[model samples]
Target: MMEYFYPEHLKKMFTNRKRELKDLEYTRDSLDKGTLRNISFFGLRRIGKSLLIKEFMYRNPGNIYINIEEIASSPEFFSLRYIGYIAYWLNENGDALPDDYMEINALIKKCTEMNIKALTDAVTKLNLEFSKEKRDHNFLLGLAFTLPEKICREKNKKIMLFLDEFQALAVLKKSPQVLNPFALFRSAIQNQSGTSYVLAGSQITKMRSILEDHKEPLFLQFNVLNIEPFTREDTYELCSKILPGQDTDIFESIYKYSYGHPFHTTSVCERVKEYSEKCELEITNELISQAFLVEVLSKEGNINKFCRYLYDISLEKARGYGILKAILTVLAEKEGTTITEIARGIKRSPQATKKYLMWLEEVDLITKYEKTYFYKDPVFRTWLAYYEKGIELGIMPKREMLKNLLSNLEEKYLRTSSELGRAKEFETKVKLEKKLGIELKNYMSKDGQIEIDLAGKKDALIYLVEIKWKNKSSDYKDIENFLKKTEKSEFSDKEKKLFFISKSGFTSSALKLAKSNNVTVLDRNLEAIEAVN
Candidate 1:
């Protein structure tokens, strides 16, 4: 009978995440049918994992959401909050209870007043047990975790329990009486029929250890859902909502700088709105540059604070914090560097640096691919570049310094986007080759005036491909340009097959032109291209 409340502003700001919502709903429906599949959501800090959970909880009633970090000061405190939240969530017209009713005494009294005998008894019993001189922490944890199932079964209802920052529960193991809290928790909920758990945490390393490491108790117990950054389309939609009347170019600039991260995108958009309102000026790339600099470099900025927290907390959790910091600094300065280069920068041996890099990787601070390492979040890397240099807090940077930083950022964005585009093009080429059974390579004119992303030759036909890995659909103009380029290229004499691979599909006119001209258009679904001889 508890009504969950989602704020109006949040509802307005919430963008497109229909797929994630559907996934959550599917799990909940499965649980309703007497099958429980627990889920654990993992993402980097400020990646909107918590917001997604909140939105899900708002839509779905009969749920209890607890942020473990806020209450998990000790085993005793966590036990009380666990029981209190369940009681509060189950109470009839629970909104009447004072905000602080989650306190042990308030929860007990509230439950008793509501004549919720099941929850009342459970809370009273827990309070009495905790007060005992020789408390059994294991028994207390079991009782706290199982109370929801017990109460829900009595009421002939089901409950979804969302634990944010669930990895914080590991701290309970430090208590002598509670040797392994995760084991106790898994044991309690392993066979529960009435309650399903959804665990989420920002600490990717700790969460992975708890849920994926075979040695851990909760290993493989929950379905893992990774909360990724918003897509470019979603980012544009969100920015449009925040700062209306902006052109596509402004929105694209925001997406390019934010990289579709909800926090970054929101921060930049909100900052732009502020500047536009105060100065009565239009939103431009220059304005975006100033907003981004303020958000990432200003001490009071939300993004700066978040990055600082991420930097400090990640180091706190990893071993050899000092060396790990050095390795991160090295990567922030020059990403995609080899272990030997990193060792040279950090003044450590390659072997020692590799160990430190592994520690950073474990914390999800940096990732390794093909023997080189890069920061998992490029925005964070940008922040660190200034942070490591002791960028003064709350001081307006010199114009030259700001220009230089923005220039570097623009360059980095172009470089990273190009790299990603190339990777996608390569993937598309491989897929096309497998589907059509043809070998492809990059093709360029002798004067470099026209370059094709991919080209292949098989039999009498030469394939010239133009790949558009962008947010917008390939339009008639794109197809026209490709045709113009082909007409001027040396391949004009050869019997050439044309391919247009667009990630966002093609516009109506583009499709019509492509079909008429016998140009195979491949979207994300490359299977359609197989029909092309």
Candidate 2:
């Protein structure tokens, strides 16, 4: 069994990421066929990018894993770790080596024992250079980066190079010893035939700039793969593993509150498990909510600390930290607000507010769609809302305060649900366009009180659609309401065909009613609406 870089417990707790794993495996297979395709994994922090990489490494041994954030404190340290990791992976049983193997002398001794003279000699020379009064930075970086490919060719072995938090390499440039680190790195790795690189970063914006920005040296050099949050099913599966035999509703609530974020889902479940064991309570929605609150609001909580770190670190990277925070606070209060509205809220001019908003976007704290800005992580926004309200640790929140927080959470959930509904409508629109081969426009009345989910003109007739994404089946009354709305709308005078799409299918009464009214009803099983001749 290959020793996992992550702890055994965490490895055991790892849940579904089959798609990402398959994608990684494809890269590995390509490498086996003598083709190297570098990949870049980018996502929000704690979104399992590192875990996914470690899992891939565990499945495919003989790989080098380096967390640049851990080792990129200085040029020399980074070079040493780079050499050490290469040597560590090269050894037949490197995991058994003493912890000091990270040191140059230990690595040199180990490489000598393994008969990897190329690496040993390189490490020795690098060690000697470091001791000198004047060191050539380019020589050190060039030697460190190219060592793997050199060693790989020497031993006739393929290597997978995983660089977690790879964006930290930019920090090395602050040192005179490592200027233009990314360009130098790109230069060294561009020709590595035997080593495939899988770079991952928690800072999405920086990673995209490094890999996708046209001006960057490494532009279009690596295939970008975004590690998304776990799905609702994955969240439930993980929660069940943490607290087995729990009700479906409990897991649903966990998915709802955690929004399928792996770390948050895990934290919420662990907290719930602790409370259940200590207080001898059954798992309930209220308990889950409290666990979430404790995880987010308690000072000693992991998520709280993480949010604080993220807030501080992100602002540290961007200019106008103070005003950036003010902008974040405004977004936390009312997300999806336009920059002009935000400027008014912050009492700043539009241009200044736009600059601050750009700073926030640069840091990946918020994203802009059209003219409105929204927090990239809604859970973080919720935390900020509570944090701004002074929800202190060591003291229970007052009843009124808890009530207010819950109310706010409920309102936010409703807004999120509405957004999801809109997403479903969009998905339906796309499917309709592809199925019917016609572009559809969303229909809304002048007063905006009446709206059709989708409408398009096909074969001299107008097709109107009403989508129901609720948990329950669309009932007879639902179809009746749709017909009434269409009848009262501006399109009433037009020859319109009616269509109903339901997520959970339709009730028998609803189906019969649709048939009698010449309406087409499609459920989840129905792929597309048939075009009437």
Q: Highest TM-score among the candidates is held by which one?
A: 2
lDDT of 2 by residue, 194-243 (tens): 88999999889988988998989999889988888886556767998999
lDDT of 1 by residue, 1-533 (tens): 22334566877788866666777888888888988878889998888887887788777766888788877867777788887777666653234443655677777778867665677777888889878998878877887888888887778888888899998897897888888888888888877888888998988987999888999998888889888898765777798899887766687678777888899999988878877888776788888877888888998677888899988877875767787777878788778899999999989899998888888887788888999998888888889988888874353456787888788777663344543453455457667889878988666665546777778889989989888988798899999999988989888889988988888888888888888888988887674543322
List of clashing residue pairs for candidate 2? none
- Could you report the Cα RMSD, in angstroms, for every candidate shown? 11.6, 11.5
What is the Cα-based TM-score of model 1? 0.78
Best candidate (score: lDDT): 2
In model 1, what is the error at residue 306, expressed in angstroms? 1.4
Q: Which ten residues in a row have the lowest lDDT in candidate 1?
A: 413-422
lDDT for position 295 in model 1: 87
Error of 1 at 251 (Å): 1.3
